[model samples]
Target: MIWLVTSICIQIICAVHVIRTGRNQIWMLFIFLFSLLGCFAYLMLEVMPAYWGNRHLRTARAQVAGKVDPERDVRRAQRDLELADTAANHIALGDAQAARGRYAEAEAAYRKGLALGPGNDWGTQVKLAQVLFERGSSREALTLLDGVPEVSRGSEWDRRGLLRARLLADLGRDAEARALFEDVMSRIAGEEARCHYAAFLIERDDRVRARQVLEEVEQRARRLDRTQRVAQADMYRWAGEKLAELRRASA
Candidate 1:
């Protein structure tokens, strides 16, 4: 009985880790099914080595010596830097650089933002978390996000929270991530939030709820900012495609 309890606890921990990492559900299931032995096997066969491999990969890929559109990225970074000497500009520059697939630049921008005064700036923290997440450092991202104060809760914070939830889901903490996502959905009635919530529902196989959330998103989109509305339209387009795919799969 104690062994069983231990196994259950290990499974739960593994699930939470997978959810936090945003890893494969199948892998989590395998760990749960095999219990402690399975968990150990997973750690040995997958988790530990993958973590080490990813760390090495990141270190090796840190430097990008390429000559592309030098003016565009530099100018874009400068413009964003000029807008708000705040940490947000650094995040913005990081995002811009990331959009261009310049991971090193993105990291530099995030680090620069972190160096400037308040290292705990919410927006900058989220941007840095995002970059870390993309770089397979979900655990590190979680560590950073964990430090964000509740008093700092806002749209950007909520978005980061959702991202953290997604990471959790990937790591195998589906229940926790689901609860967090639901909380975010409750607070955010906006189109983007609704769309994201719908996606989360779909992931959980809650098709009906997902559909309802998408409809709500579409309705709310009508009253949002022009840019947000456009983004909503794009979300709807993607939702439509997903719906079609689901239908076809069901059929």
Candidate 2:
């Protein structure tokens, strides 16, 4: 009696769920006619996949939506900040704001992240300096970079190095910037750095070496894997343009 009642209850619950889900009428028929076996089939074939698929889609959509409407994240983070102004959270918001060209807001958020103490002081400074650099605050940007204490071979190092190199070039510290590029050549593994070095060489009237470097950059760009190619698409194009320019100049 107990077993029979339990089977009926399971079938009824699954049948109503399937019906409300608005799936094939066949599912309701199977549930009503086949009982527990039908419920099991419905769960395996429809319920589980629908649940998991919706989960993945929700996660993917949220991530994509963040990029689509950058301000949406800012608002969400602000709400969180109202309750708990954690350093990590502030940095995340700052990053989003920075990506959207809201440098002032990003700067404030990064400063708050820094003041929150020990969230990610090094990273926060790098991002803040990036904003300052974009805004033509070169000296301030350099100061933040100089305060970083150490420079190593990592994505962070590449970022700081690129900014530092550009600052040096803009301030007419060509020698230092060229030397920095040479250092970067040893540390980084992309054609873009070489392209920058080639430009510096071109500026110095070393056309031969510049041509050689550009050719090498072209070869390297051609050899990049799919992931690297995506990462260096702009650089690849720049190097190709530089190569063509060099050729015409030589011709």
lDDT of 1 by residue, 208-231 (tens): 777766666556656765544443
Candidate 2: list runs displaced more than 4 Å: 1-83, 118-120, 151-159, 199-207
- All models: lDDT? 0.69, 0.77
lDDT of 2 by residue, 1-251 (tens): 99999999999899889678875566777687888987876676556643465554444444434443447767777788788879888888888788788898888888888998764478779888888877788888888888886766697777678779977876789889988887877667666678778878888888888889889887776776655565456777877887898899989
* Best by the lDDT measure: 2
Which consecutive 10 residues in model 2 have the weakest lDDT in total? 59-68
| Backbone clashes under 3 angstroms, per model | 15, 0
Query: Which sections of candidate 1 miss by over 4 Å?
Result: 1-74, 78-92, 99-104, 116-118, 222-228, 231-233, 247-251
Query: What lDDT score is found at residue 185 in candidate 2?
Result: 72
So what's the TM-score on candidate 2?
Answer: 0.62
**Model 1: lDDT to the true structure:** 0.69
